[model samples]
Target: MSWRGKRKVEKPKSEEETSSNKNPKLESSDDSDNLFVCEISKNRRVAVRSWQGNPVVDIREFYVKDGKQLPGKKGISLSMEQWNILRKHMDEIDEAVAENS
Candidate 1:
């Protein structure tokens, strides 16, 4: 007598079920939608404020690993669209600085 005959077989999960368990949400947008790029440490925090004394946002987080960019734990986050907007205005800021200098 074969011992296999006494063993019970398990059914495999469907592809849809397997996928759902892996990634529950295929569409999600949060921090990736904001404009808060770049992280600054306590020591380097002054660097951010020194930019032409212009007003801007500064986000601090503890989850961010050293040497890592923003969007870190408590760090700023920016979406692709937000980045594009800033990039477009960079030329203007550069021009203003050049004129003043």
Candidate 2:
């Protein structure tokens, strides 16, 4: 007898079943002072949140570990001053991108 013939066929799961297994992390907690959050990709996000007593813009990459999403080391937190400077230079940045492309 061929061992391949003894394999069991598994039934396909429904959309609900498949969807229930996917747990996306929340942008902020109940007590968190997050102003905004935007997902740029499946694992990358940009968020404005309060740190200590000051607000900072955080651009971070998240990873799934033990069924939970955790921030990875590949990220940067910009202070308000830095964020403002970046915001002011957006037009120049756009021009550079347009030129490069």
Candidate 3:
């Protein structure tokens, strides 16, 4: 056997990386726990995420500055409990709208 110094060494691939390589758009399990943005309007959106192991919902405003839609200063982050309360009220609004329709 000749000297094997010509062999290239490579670090082991992570489980996530190997699976993702088989499918470029493969979303890992961790991605499910990530923030999901829900568009509310043309210049506004909501993001529900987990921060520091706590559930949170972020409501933010967007502005078109220099033709670039960017986040504005108007924003609020609420805990899961607060979000549940707001969601309850939103359900009432949904009921009213459905009744009108």
Candidate 4:
């Protein structure tokens, strides 16, 4: 038996990755989780995520300016209606933050 045959290599993928990739774009669990992440800088970042089984929302901002994790503002739970209202004002909120900085 010659060992010169081209061997097919298969890359291992996690269950989460497989599920997300197999599902339709709109049906992705991550999208439904009400999670959003944005990079503010090389080390600064912001994330918005929903609480378990609730419409409650949370926002966190952090950074790693110099190998250390820098702390930032954090917000807690919010009502579903309140979240909707916030979404509507997202652009304005961003602008306000930018103006403040």
On TM-score, who's better, 1 or 4? 4
Every candidate's lDDT:
0.34, 0.61, 0.55, 0.44
Measured by TM-score, the strongest candidate is 2
* Candidate 4 local lDDT, 24-55, one digit each (tens): 22122333543333333443433343445564
- Residue 58 displacement in candidate 3 (angstroms): 1.2
Per-residue lDDT of model 2, residues 1-101, tens digit only: 32122222122234353235443333443324554355666677676666767888888777776666667778888999999999999999999999999
Candidate 3 per-residue C-alpha lDDT over 30-67 given as tens digits, one digit per residue, 9 for 90 to 100:
43443434556666656555556777786877676555
How does model 2 score by TM-score? 0.67
Candidate 3 runs further than 4 Å off? 1-34, 50-53, 96-101
The stretch of ten residues in a row with the least summed lDDT in candidate 3 is 2-11
Across 1-101, the per-residue lDDT of candidate 1 in tens digits comes to: 32112222111234444334332221113221122222233322111111133333434343223443222234343444555687799999899999999
lDDT (C-alpha) at residue 70 in model 2: 65
- Residue 38's C-alpha lDDT in candidate 3? 52
* Candidate 1 lDDT score at position 84: 65
Ordered list by TM-score, greatest first: 2, 3, 4, 1
Clashing pairs in 4: none
